[model samples]
Target: MKVGLYFGSFNPIHVGHLVIANHMAEYSDLDQVWFVVTPHNPFKKKNSLLDDYQRLEMVYRATKDYTKLKPSDIEFKLPQPNYTINTLAYLQDKYANFEFALIMGEDNLKSFHKWKNYDVILENHHVYVYPRISGNHIETQFDNHTKIHHIDAPVMELSSTFIRKAIKAGKNVKPMLPEFVWEYLDEMNFYK
Candidate 1:
């Protein structure tokens, strides 16, 4: 199976994330899109995030109905502060028959070169880049790279930070989240 790994913190899975994942699964050649719930992102502050299992639960609740979208806790089982290169290597070894690709926003592409063993990742897997509103400059080398594909997906500006803040301030951000995820967050009193 051709799978696109959509790695994120998914502190509270929201509609914006669903839209992009659905778009990739339906519009692209990818057969499925797996939302890899990262336990901790090296770039993000750990304290700001919810419990790893809590975030994973939100992801599972959000993606339960989508047959093409799956929630993966693969990173949770792996080491903390994991890099994309290591995850890619691990996935490649475990699922030799499955072709794995990356699903990322345009903003991340700007710093792609800085990733550890990025060259090896580019050579091994295809990167499916979705549009982001961020006006960051991308490297000229990846502009026309064969391994990098710029998908004409919608620009999702909504972020988990915004949702968390909104909920904390006693705002009804239910519309921003999936029905089940909203219920789960509300019941758990997360971010409030």
Candidate 2:
């Protein structure tokens, strides 16, 4: 099976994420898109993130109805400061039958070189990059081995940090996340 691994913290899985994953699965050769919920990203600030389990649960709840979309806790069991290269290696070893590709926004591609063993990652895996406001200039820097495809997924200005700020300010996030996920967030008093 060809799977596109969409990795993120997903503090609260939003519609924009769902749309992009669905778009990748429907438009590309991928059979499924797995939301690999990262426990902790090496490049991001740890203080700004929620618990890994909580983020995974929100992703699970938000994508429950979609069989094509799955929430994976693969990174939860892996070592801290999750890196894409390591995760790819682990997944390849664990699921030998599955062919995986990296799914990410073009914005991330701009700083791709900063990642650990990025050259190996580019050589081994396919990357499906969606259009973003930034990172267009970095497209020409990719080598022949790095398969980068541009997608037309809708752009959403929302981010997990914005959602957290809204919740902390007692603002409504109903428009930002799915109904069930918002209920879970409210019930647990998360982001309070």
Candidate 3:
């Protein structure tokens, strides 16, 4: 099976994330799309994130109904400040029968070159990119790269940071999240 790994902190899983993952699962050749909840991203600050399991629970709540979508806590066991390349290598070894790919936004593509062992990632796996509203310019080397496939998915500007801020401000951001996720967050009283 071909699986696409969609990595994120998922501070709280929202509809925008579901849309993209579902689009990749349904519109692309990937048999499954795993939401790899990162425990700690090297690029992001730890204080802004919820506990790893909480974020994973939110992802679970968001993807439970979709057979093609899954929530993975693979990074939780990995070393701190793990890189995508390391996770990719680990997954490749563990699931030898399954082919793994990456699902990313166009904005990430702009800085793809800066990632550790990026060339190795490109050499081993395919990258599926969805459009972003950001104005950043993508690297020229990736323009027509055979390993990279640009998917024409919807442009999702909705973000977890925006949702968190709204919740802290006592705004109704319920509609931005999945019903179950919203209920979980409401029960847990997160962000507020």
Q: Give the TM-score of candidate 1.
A: 0.94
Task: Please count the clashing residue pairs in each candidate, in the order shown.
Answer: 0, 0, 0
Among all candidates shown, the one with the greatest TM-score: 3
Ranking by TM-score: 3, 1, 2
RMSD of each: 2.0, 2.5, 1.9
How would you encode candidate 3's per-residue C-alpha lDDT over 1-192 as one tens digit per residue?
A: 999999998998899999999999999999999999988655776676898899999999899899999999999999987899999989999999999999999988878999999999999999999988764546657999999999889888999999999999999998899999999999999999
Give the candidates in order of lDDT, highest first: 3, 1, 2
- How displaced is residue 8 in candidate 1, in Å? 0.6
As a whole number from 0 to 100, the lDDT of residue 139 in candidate 1 is 58
| Model 2, span 1-192: residue lDDT tens | 999999887977887888899999998989999999877655676765778788898999998988899999998888776678889999999999998999988788778888899888877888888876553445546634437777777767778888888999999988889888999999999889
Instruction: Locate the minimum summed-lDDT window of 10 residues in model 1.
Output: 132-141
State the TM-score for model 3. 0.94
**Alpha-carbon shift of residue 178 in model 2 (angstroms):** 1.3
| Model 3 misplaced regions, further than 4 Å | 41-45, 134-139
TM-score of each: 0.94, 0.89, 0.94
